[model samples]
Target: MLDPLRNQSVIFDFIEKEEYFAIHAPRQTGKTTLLHELAHRLNKEGNYISVVFS
Candidate 1:
């Protein structure tokens, strides 16, 4: 489920650097899914706790 995001180096770099960022896109474009996937991965890494609220 996280495969697409897993392969995005830029996104990984942003996360690895602990930088603040946002994902903006038109409706029905997977913004929420990406955030959920990111939160799941971040939690699995045990380095940070990520959450999504919408």
Candidate 2:
């Protein structure tokens, strides 16, 4: 679920700190959906500009 990404403290820390990072995972694991959702949320929060390059 979305919690899997939203609840990742390290990830939020990295994003909050503006640190460069990457998310690696196998195929069909909801990576894209997660990213889009994250971007939407982040944008809605009016903090960062999140985009998915694919």
Candidate 3:
């Protein structure tokens, strides 16, 4: 499995700034996976409440 947080500085920046954003990508390109990982990380850090809805 790929490290979803790897090379996601921009996304993390947006998150840190408390800004809204979207993730666009082709199907099966790991969009959901990335979201899940991000949510997990955020929750683990005890900073923000994250959830993935599909």
Candidate of highest lDDT: 3
Task: Write down the worst ten-residue block by lDDT for model 3.
Answer: 1-10
Model 2 lDDT per residue over 2-54, tens place: 35555456667878887977877787777677777777778888977777787
lDDT of 3 by residue, 1-54 (tens): 434566366688999998988877778878788888788888998989987887
Clashing pairs in 3: none
lDDT of 1 by residue, 1-54 (tens): 334555456677887897867666678777677777777888898988877786
- TM-score of every candidate: 0.69, 0.70, 0.78
Best first by TM-score, ranked: 3, 2, 1
Model 1, C-alpha of 26: deviation from truth (Å): 1.1
lDDT of each: 0.71, 0.72, 0.78
CA error at residue 34 for candidate 1, angstroms:
0.2
Query: What C-alpha root-mean-square deviation, in Å, does candidate 2 show against the real structure?
Result: 2.6
Model with the higher TM-score, candidate 1 or 2: 2
Candidate with maximal TM-score: 3
Root mean square deviation (Cα) for candidate 1? 3.3
Q: List runs of model 2 lying over 4 Å from the truth.
A: 1-3, 6-9
Report each candidate's C-alpha RMSD, comma-separated, in the order given.
3.3, 2.6, 2.5
